[model samples]
Every structure is written in C-alpha cells, then in structure tokens.
Target: MSALDFIPELGHRVRESVPRLGAATRFLVLGLGRPFHRHFSIQQWLRQVYGFGVLSLALMVVAAFFTGMVLGFQGYYALVRFGATSALGTLVALSLLRELGPVLTALLFAGRAGSALTAEIATMKATEQLSAMEMMAVDPLAWVVAPRLWAAVFTVPILCVIFDLVGIFGGYLIAVPVLGVDSGTFWSQMQSNVSFRGDILNGLFKALCFGLVVAWIAAWQGYSAQPTAEGVGNATTRSVVAASLAVLGLDFILTALLFS
Candidate 1:
C-alpha cells in the first residue's frame, strides 16, 4: 500500500492499455466505415432498436420518474429557503432538459443495453459464430456489428427525450398537488425559461454522442473479447464501466463547449 508501490502497477496498466486502445480504435474505424460499403438493412437495425430501446423502456420510465421526484423535493426545499419556490419548475425542467435527462439516460443505457450488447457479441465470439459468418463469405462487421451500432446511435436520443418528458411530469406531480405549488406557475415558469435551441437540443445532442460512445465501446469490447465464458463476463463489465466513464467525461467537455 506504499505510494511508490502503486507507480509500477499504474505504469504496467498504462502499457497494457495502450495497445488495447489502439486495437479498439481500429475496430471502431471499421465498424463506422464498413457499413457504408455494404447494402443497408433496415430490418436488422430495427431489431436492434427493439432490443436496445423498446426492451429498456420500463426501466427508463421508472428511473426517470423517481429521479424527477427526488429532484422536485430537493429543488423545492433549496429554492424555498430563498423564497424562490416559484422557480421549482424552472429548476426541475432546466435540470432535466439540460443535464439529468441525457446523462442519466446514457448511464442507464450503458448499464442495461451496452452490457447486453457486449455480452451477446462476446458469447457469439466464444461460440465461434463470428468466425462462422466469415466462412460463409459474410462480413461479421457488416452483418453483426453495423446494425447494432446504428440502432444504438439512433435510439438513445429518443429514449432521452422520453426520459425528459416523463421526468418533468413526475416533478410536476410532486410540485403541484403534492407540494401545493400552483400548476400554472410551475409550467409557465418552465416554458418561459426552457428554450428549444438551448436546453432541449443540447440534451439531445449529448444523448446522440453518448449513444455513439456506448455502442462503439460495447461493440469493440465484445468483438475483441477472449473466446471464453469468463471473458464474456469481463468484457460486459468493461463495456459498462468504460461507457459510463466516457459519457461522464464527454458530458463535462460538451457542457463546457455548449454553455461556455
């Protein structure tokens, strides 16, 4: 546990990760590029959309609702201290539409669907299915990887929008009747403050970026997984951890760029 003891381990990790990151970058380039060379399959993309988006809808709704309700309680109390309870809707709406909605949706999606994507691909690799596709003159990158990548890139923003709407409603339910704030004041303040070009669009853009990060990381982790059951589990875990960290890091950079 000595401070000096950590340096060699950290350096070892950095050395190992440099090559892996390079390999992943190559995989990403092929994943993004190969689809353009092949005939597109809308059906394949739709199937993946269902898996990544529709299947995860209930989780999104429940998480978003509770998150909004929590925000309502916190925002109301924090604002009321300054006699600014009337800004509750503004607080909740701006928070959701700008930051919470996209970021939380991405984290949840990375945990749920990104892990699933990595697990599925890793299992297929473990079972030699990707190799079998190659033997049949089919490119696995095009047939397997592209659809899921595009589907995730498309669905996450839609999910974020849904999260925002549901979260706002949950906050309203708490702020209005439950907390006795006027409904009109709540919504009107939100409407007056929230803007299409600023709040909503920025969130959707963040969602889009997160989708790409989740899909790319998950796909690369699975594609590069060791062909073993234990490797599949490890790859899935890595996908979630990597995607979540990437989303958070990107959020800070993007927020600064968009707002500053």
Candidate 2:
C-alpha cells in the first residue's frame, strides 16, 4: 500500500481501538463497583473463590515445588563454581520470592484460570444465557463479572504466598539434604537477606496486580466475544495470551519500581 493509504488505515485502526479500550475500562470500573451495590451476594464471590483458588490449588503447589527444586539444583551448580554455595539459600529464596514465585504463578494462572474464565463467560454468551439474565431484569455484569473478578483479585496473592512457601521448602529440601549443604548456613543466609516487607509484601503486591490484569482481560474478552463456538475458542486463546504478556510486562515495571 502507498504511504498515504497506510497512514489513514493506521489512523482508522487507532480510532477503532479507542472505543474498545473505553468499553473495557468501563466494564472494569462497573464490575468493581457492582459489589458495593445493595443487592450484592457474598456467596457468589465465595463460589468464585473456590473456582479460582481451590480448584487450582494442586496445580499451583506442584508447579511451585518443582520450580523451587529446579532453582535449587541450578543455583547450587552455579554457585559451587565460585565457592559460594553457602549463599545458595539467599539466592534461591530471593529469586523465588521476588521474581519466580509471583511471575510464574501469574503466567500459570493466566494459562489455566484465565483461559477457563474466558471460555465460561464466552460459552454463556454464545448460549444466550447472558441475554436471558438481562430479560429477567438482572444485571449480568453484577452477577457474572464482579464476583469472579474480585475472587481472582483476592485469591491469586494467596496462591502466590502458597507458591512461595512450598517453593522455599522444596529448595530447602534439595539444598540441605540432597545437595549436602549445611542446613544451618542455608537458613541463616536466607533469613539474613530476605526481609518480610521488601520481599514478601512486594511480591504479594505484584501478584495482586497480575490477578486483576488476568481476570479483567479474561472477563472483557469473553463479554466482547462474537457469541459463536469459534469465537468462544478464540476469546479463550486471546485471554491467555493477552494476560500472560501483560503479566510479564507489568512484572518488569513493578520490579523496576519496587527494587530499582
């Protein structure tokens, strides 16, 4: 295409994107605010918590354990070269708590929970269940969106904490018993370097932001989906992809802000 033709096309695309972004933003604001409305039900949020947190518990714990074990093995080998294997505890703990724990958990949450959310909502839309709710004088956004969003926003940080704890245990098991490092030194180094506020709180904050991003993106994609089988599948895929990228991108920004 000619340069002039490309310029107008780009401008048209940008203009189209404005409304879509505005809709998503409005959706987020409304969904968040809906819980404060008088008719809000705590049970709905609880059910979503079970769906987003309890159902994903095993997956999160298992992944965290293996990730920590892998970090332990690699950290030992790398640190052994410099005769600094004693510091393995600090390395593994900081890496997991500050970076791996929250980031990996977020990615997994995006792939698993986020995709499920999108598919469920999109399916409801495709089957006209959302429209049916409207016909019944229900606000679908309040019933369908708020609870899921808040549950996700709340649960992921808890999952992140679980991931950190399980991962640290896994690393300790490998570092102290399997790798033949002194148990005392491992605990000492980690305890000395890792502070609760700097490491744990910061990581939890990151997880919170990531959860919001994941749930919001998933819900928006599903709500905006084309209400067909193919569209639902596409929305699910897009939710995961978009949420994952947003988590990574946000992680970098958070890291720079919190640590640097």
Candidate 3:
C-alpha cells in the first residue's frame, strides 16, 4: 500500500478507537455505580468470586512458592558474601510483600483469569447471546460485566495477600530448614523490618489497582469485539497483553507516588 493510503487507515483506526474508549469508560462508571442503587444479586457476586478468586488459588500458591524459594536461595548467597545472612528473612519478606508479590500475581491473573473473561464474553457476543439479552429487555452490561468487574476488584487483593503469605513460608522453608538459617531469627527479623502499612498494605493497594485495570480491559475488549470466532480470539489475546502492560506501568506509577 502507498504511504497516503496507510495514513487514512491509521486515522480511521484512531477515530474508531477513541469512541470505543469513551464507551468503555462510561460502561465502567455505570457498572461501578449501579450496584449501589439497584438490587445486585449476592448469588451472582459469589459466583464470580468463586470463579475469579477460588479457581485461581492453586496457581497462585504454586507461583508464590517457587518465587519465594528462588528469593531465599539468592538472598542467602548475596547476604552471606557480606556476612549479613541474618538479614535474609527481612529481604525475602519485604521483597515479596512490597514488589514481586503484587506484580507477579497481577501478571498471572492477567494471563489466566483476564484472558478467560475476555474469551467468555467475546464468545457470548459471537453467539448472539448478548444481543438476545438486550432484546429481552435485560441489561447485559449490568448483569454480566458488572459482577465480574467487582469480583476481580475484590479477588485480586485477596490473591495478593495469599501470594505474600505463601511466598514468605516458602522463603522460610528454604532459609531455615534447608539453608540452616536460624528459624527464630528468620521470623523475628521479618517482623522487625517489614512495616504493615509501608509494605503489606501498599502491596494490596497495587493489587486493587491492577485488578480494576485487568478486569476493565478484559470486559471492554470482549464487549466491543466483532461478533466472530476470530474476533473473540483476538480480543482475548489483546486483553491479556494490555492488562499485563497496564499492571507493570501502573506499578511504577504507584510505587513512585506511594513510596517516593
């Protein structure tokens, strides 16, 4: 294609995307508000909680375990060189609670839960299920999208907490029993160095932001996808990629604002 031809196509794509972005924002605002005013079903919310939170528990635990082991191993060696091996517990706990715990949990959520959500919604659209709901006077956005969004909002922080806990245990396993670090010192030093507000709560805050971003991108992409199998697949892919990028970018911004 000629350069001039590409210009028109690029402009067209930008114009198309702008309105969709606005619509998605509106959808999120309305979804967030509606539950407060209307009678949202507790059953639906619980179902989403199970789907988004419970279903992903095993994977989160596994990831946290391996991550903690690696941190323990590396931190032990690093601190040993400086004769500060006693600080290993503090290093592992703080590192997991403050940074890796939230970031990696979010990336995993995006890859696993976020992609599934996009695919599910897009497939529904592809099959005309969304249209059917609309024709029957049911607000699909409120019924389908809102619950998932709220679920994700709640679930991610819970998952992050779990990740931090499990990761710390894994670190302790490696540091204490395997590496011969003093068990009492491990727990004690962690308690002394890691502040609840500065590390743990801030990590949860990051998880909350990541949850919203991941859910929003997944739902919006699915809702706006073209009604076709290929479109649904593409939307799922985009949702994962976009949510991952959003998590990393937001992590940097939040760290600067909250810590710096």
Candidate 4:
C-alpha cells in the first residue's frame, strides 16, 4: 500500500478509538463519584488508608531527607556568591513545597503503590476473582475501588509532608555541618522567610490531587485489563506511565492557577 493509503487507514482507526477513550473516561468519573459517598464502609476505608499512609511513610521520609540535603548543598554556594545566603530558607521552602515534595512523593507512590494496586487487581482479574465478585452481586466499584481511591486522596498529602520534613532536615544537616551555618540562625531564617500558608497548603494540595490521579489511573487500567497475563503486564506498565505524566501535567496547570 502507498503511504497515503496507510495514512487514511490510520485516521479511520484513530476515530474508531475515540469512543473507547470516552467510555473509559466516563467509567473513571463514575468511579470517582462514589468514592466519597456515605456508604463507602468504614472498615474498608481504614484498611486502604492505612496501607496508603503507613506503608509508604518510611520510604517518603528517607527520600525527602536526602532530597532536602542535596538542594541545600547545591543552592548554598550559589546564594553565597550573590551575598544572598539568607535566601536559602526561602529557596528550600519554595522548591520543596512547590516541586520536590509533591513531585517526588507522587512519582514514588506511582511506582510503589500504583504498581502494587495494578498488579493486585490484575492478578485478581486473571484468577477470575473479579468475575466471582460480580457473580455474587458485589459491586466491585464499591468494595474495591472506593476505599482505595479515598485512601490515596487522603494519604498522598501526608506523604508529601513526610517528604518535606526529610528534605528540610537533610538541608539542615548539610548547612549546619558543612557550611557552618549557625543552627539557630538557619531555623530563624526559615521561620521568618517561609510562609506556612503558601508553601504548606500548596504542596498539600498538589499531593492530594496527585494521589487521586495515580490511584484512579492505576485502578482504571487494571480493572479494564484484558484477561491474559501479558495484558496484565501491559496494564501495569501503562498505569505507571499514565499516572506519572498526569501528575506532571496537572502540577503545571495547578501551579499556573494557584500562583497566577
């Protein structure tokens, strides 16, 4: 076939796929709608919340601590040259609150929790457990998706806080030990320079949105996976890619909206 012939054929398939995308989007919205309702079961909610929060806490802490230290070391000398060493706190606060805290935590959560959720659901689908649930008249949306979605929404911001704490401590260690910054002065600068409302709230907001995106993407992908091992593998991979990209895209949009 000529190249032009192939192009027309491709356009036809692209148009055909649009409806499937729309269907998926609709299903996603439905899933999100019921996640916050009164019937969303306290027991199930507690389980997923604990899983999302407590399970991920240690990892977030370590990651943030190291991230903070690196930011401090990297920014310190640059600020010193401009006689703006006092700007370190503002720099750390802004960078962590705006970028590193939410982004890194989301990426980690996508890799860890997102993958786990995808795999778990994919495995269940493969084993026909999902089918069994349907046969029993149990709404998988209510029993499976709602709790996890809400849990992720609530847990992500908490994880972001953990990330911020670790990152700041890392900065403190590097600044105090290596740069010889007076501990009291460094903390005082941070307190005076960093506005809690702007920095903390913005970061937490980003984290919450990221959590929702990651969980929904992973769940939607996994739940809709074809009934084959290879399909499950593909779903898992796609879940991570989609969640990460969405997190980045949403962050940019949120930044513009919040800051503008």
Q: Against the hidden true structure, what lDDT does model 1 obtain?
A: 0.92
* Global lDDT scores for all candidate models: 0.92, 0.94, 0.92, 0.86
TM for every model, in the order presented, reads 0.94, 0.97, 0.93, 0.91
How many Å off is the CA of 16 in candidate 4?
4.3
Residues 31-98, candidate 2, lDDT per residue (tens digit)?
99999765467999999999899999999999999999999999999999999999999999999999
Q: Write the per-residue lDDT of candidate 3 for residues 56-128, one digit (tens) a residue.
A: 9999999999999999999999999998889999999999988999999999999999999999999999999
Better of 2 and 4 by lDDT: 2
Q: Pairs clashing in candidate 3?
A: none
lDDT of 2: 0.94
Q: After superposition on all CA atoms, what RMSD does each candidate show versus the true structure?
A: 1.9, 1.2, 2.3, 2.2
Show where candidate 2 strays beyond 4 Å. 1-6
13: Cα error in model 3, Å: 6.2
For 43-117, candidate 4 gives per-residue lDDT tens digits of: 998998888789988888888888998889888988988977777766776789888899999999999999888
Q: Model 1: residues >4 Å from true position, as ranges?
A: 1-15
Error of 4 at 237 (Å): 1.0
Tens digits of per-residue lDDT for model 1 on 143-216?
Answer: 88888988998999999999999999999999998999989999899999999989999999999999999999
